[model samples]
Target: MPLPHRVSDLSAFDLLLSVAELGSIGAAARAHAITQPTASARLSGLERGLGIALLDRTARGSRLTRDGALVADWARTAVGAAAALDVGITSLRRTRESRVPVAASLTVAEYLLPHWLAALRPSAEGASVALTTGNSDDVAAAVLAGEARLGFVEGPDVPAGLTAATVGRDTLTVIVRPGHRWARRRSGITADELAATALVSRERGSGTRRALERALRRGTDRPLEEPLLELSSTTAIKAAVAEGVGPAVLSSLAVAAELAAGTLIRVPVVALDLTRELRVVHPAGQALTGTPRTLAAIARRSASLDDPAG
Candidate 1:
């Protein structure tokens, strides 16, 4: 059925609800950010259009009449339903845009991407994201192959044929279980001592592993020792460390909760730089536009919220 011609104005209904809530036309006008005179004129027009007295006005204030109270109750539901319909339309538009394909390294995929996506929704951006998770190299490959339109990674360098914007930084922390020997050390361990030891590690291509190797190489000419155990996922590595598997160097992003809860101990490493850039990457010549661009800006702005200092 068609909406009634007499009550077709949704804004007027919204204003009516506001007046009902605030108890005065002037207060409602302030809430809606309009002039009191404009508010009074609009409400008057509404009553005239509906052929009913919706307000009982006196010198002190305006209050809803008996008929006005009933109309206000119905208007509340109408306004709520209209708002829900608008949200549904925005969601449909997002679907029609097709989820913006994103490739992200495990750290970003697990820890940061959801927050970025959350920031997008309330703004009515009419876009959505479909995420693919992997190591930094895998993320780069996905973007280059057209499998993803945008990619996020943390590492010493952006891969060839891609350009990156630094959105944040990740500090690789050397962590061990609370009972481990390094946990009680009064002095920081040297890079040589770290490189010579076998510890649990991320698989070779992971940004976490690469950042550690790059930092260790600066202080030694010898190749780094093999991992005691190699894990593909950050969560698994954290679990292994907490179980006293061995020491592992991981992104601060990955081990924050464990450190906070005393489940893991952060062993200081002297004279080593374990910090790496967290970046958003795309094809070399292609500039980000639309949703991806906006998301990247949000990432840059929100960078400092969770990261541990280097």
Candidate 2:
């Protein structure tokens, strides 16, 4: 509904109340940090809108007339209520800015997010982060469904309803137990050879699995063989590979420790690009703001340090 003209300018009403309380136009103007003439003009406009003589101007100063006093009393309620409303809105905004909900694929959650969040703490003030870990597909779904305000994904493709920015890069590694025959090869295997072999692999929706499949599809026309075994977590895949279950494709970030410890061997794949982008995603039409935006910036900076080339 349209506001009535008489009460439309709340600032004018506030000035009127101030004038009534202070008993002079100059004092009211000083209290509101406005010049006397400006305050007088605003009150004049308000009186005209309300169709009432609101002030009695004299040589010494200005004072509220009988009608003006009645209006001032009524205006006080509105002005006080508006003040209360402003406080409430500010509180709500602060609460929203201090809480951030994020979804991330397993690899990023396990390896990257802890550091990123740690860096976020200083700038975030008292803001708290609620993290959800899942496969890339699940992260995308959470963002689309409004279950998470921001999402990090390791897969190559962004979901249709989300906007994404590449925050970093990760390379998939072909790892095997030291006793496996592929571990002994001084030279890497071809894409066709890798695709034909059944290896312990992540579940279908995992970003690591998706990245490997995307790379192989580009390099080979041969139908990709099924995994010898499907495991859900990178830790499980690493454990299986360590026990000589078979070779598995994993993110280099995931197998760094085992490789350093000589428990796992990295087998290079020839002419196949195993690198995939790490991305931060949000709903397509909405702009990221508050804590989410700050966290994304932190994530990008931190990830860049992880890959100096990014």
Candidate 3:
């Protein structure tokens, strides 16, 4: 007799988890660098393996069934453990590489630092860089705990034991899918309109969320309505918006592809500039003028956000 159900595989699990965070099959596949049909197939197979439905699909997008949400959280824990194992293996390689670890908040990690690190490779003096990504608060904690030597944050506040320097700026854009009503034109919209609708956004303590709240309050009433969907990752927020979950405010630097492909439309807000400076911060009284210096140099050289076409 054949098996009643196969044990969960990594791809299926990851896809399900991604879909749960991401809210759409196409968006989930894109997150993992796969195609939509392939993601759909993997998810379907996983549903069969479990003999239960995982997603609650609708015209708006996908949501996890209560069971799926619980399973996704469990799967994420398992995947994180697997990653820790891989990291442990790398540590046992007995290599002579330098152990300089860099922690960056999600915005910097997704938009800026990768380019900087790529260009910085030539000057690394054979040192290897280990990157850890988290929220601004979490990145600061990582650095304070000695897990990373440097951090990048986008907001104005400075962490204790850290000195910050302005590196660049990222402007936030109110965005929605091409099919969204606001995307029909380029004229500025009123804050009252936004306050009346469903808003999908990042969760608390996110630099983007803080910045957005400040910007919104500049024109709207005090303490706007709660978000329709609140997520932790920029990519996840984008996915939700793409599936017509609701309109969102996001960094222009983060949505280059969607803007270029016409998948997302940028709406205008008059006198409502939503720009924030990106900063590099590290331990105070310490000159980051060494290998980190070279890394920063490389980051500036390869900063892809400056030139999105490349």
Candidate 4:
């Protein structure tokens, strides 16, 4: 089977999708590093080629017409497939070279690292990546032991032997099922209440667990109690919480979709700050160079884009 000639122009599809997302052809041009005239010409060319009016141009901005909206939806699918192909090709190239080995904590690996990797891929030249997933402790150990060129961790305290640069921020949220008692509480849970409750939790070495323990220990002498169930993975904890096993603390990134869907309700923790810095780590005294440096830059850029204030 052969594809249509118009479908072969992936860059045009990507540009169209970007325009749809950004809401203006000029904005999309700037984002794609092209001049407004160039974007306008390209879009006009695409419209003429397809024999359809794609955009309703206005003085304020441009918007997709009904037909354009349908085409943009299809363009989004094509762009996503192209991105997957790009990543796959990069991974294959990595296997043949001395790829930069990266170790990252589970939250970061699952939610943020993929975007960073994608941002780095096109400009990476011949560079490739090998990623390892672990807890904060494991990531730090991998970087310090020289097993990984770079590492990402979610904990507040950086390990002794690693130099860390704050790359992003993740807020740990307290969540419970719809029917849980905490979900119906009018007042936020106090620090003491959170500490004493035997809820589902991560393992001891996890960054999420560490952040919770630190918050619980503040302004009180009460020792943290053991969790009702200690799980090593965030997925397991989320599942348990949704099943009404117990309320659990998890990264906001991990539970965003569930929260939006109303499957998980956020229970505010009064007098406790659960926010944690996400950091990129490398062995102390080792200057970041080559692929690691590029990766760090991409991570920071990705973080800035996610930050509303940035």
Residues 1-310 of candidate 2 have per-residue lDDT tens digits of 9988779789998998888788889999999999999999999898888899999999888888999999989989989999999999999988877878899999899989999998888888989998999999999999999989999999888879999998988888899999999888879899999999998999988888898899999999988999999998999999999988899998888888888888999888889888889999999999998789988998888784242111
Q: Write the per-residue lDDT of candidate 4 for residues 1-310, one digit (tens) a residue.
A: 7888877787876788778889999999999999999999999889988899999999988988999999989888778988999999988866644478999999999988899888888777777788999999999989888889989998878978889999877788898999998899868788888888898999988998988788777745777778999999999999999999999998888888889899999988887877778999998899888678988998887784232211
lDDT against the true structure, per candidate, is: 0.87, 0.89, 0.77, 0.86
Runs with alpha carbons beyond 4 Å of true place in candidate 1: 1-96, 305-310
The candidate maximizing TM-score is 2
What does the lDDT read for residue 133 in candidate 2? 94
**What TM-score does candidate 3 reach?**
0.63
Window of ten residues with lowest summed lDDT in model 2 = 301-310
Q: How far is candidate 3 from the true structure (C-alpha RMSD, Å)?
A: 26.5
Cα lDDT of model 1 by residue, 155-242, tens digit: 6678788989998877888999999999999597988889998999999788888888988999777678999999998889999999
Candidate numbers sorted by TM-score from highest down: 2, 1, 4, 3
In model 4, which regions exceed 4 Å deviation? 1-98, 304-310
User: Model 3, range 1-310, lDDT digits (tens) per residue?
Assistant: 6423464467688788888877898899999999888988888888887888889878788888988888888789877777798898888643424667898888789877767777677777667888998777777778777787788876557777987776777787788888887887667687777656668988776777777777777767845878898898888989999998999987788888888988888887766657777777778887776567777656545544442422
lDDT of 2: 0.89
Q: Model 4: which ten-residue window has the lowest total lDDT? A: 301-310
Best candidate per lDDT, number? 2
Q: Could you tally the backbone clashes for each prediction?
A: 0, 0, 1, 0
45 in model 2: Cα distance from truth in Å?
A: 2.5
Query: TM-score of the candidate numbered 1?
Result: 0.67
Model 1 lowest lDDT segment of ten: 301-310
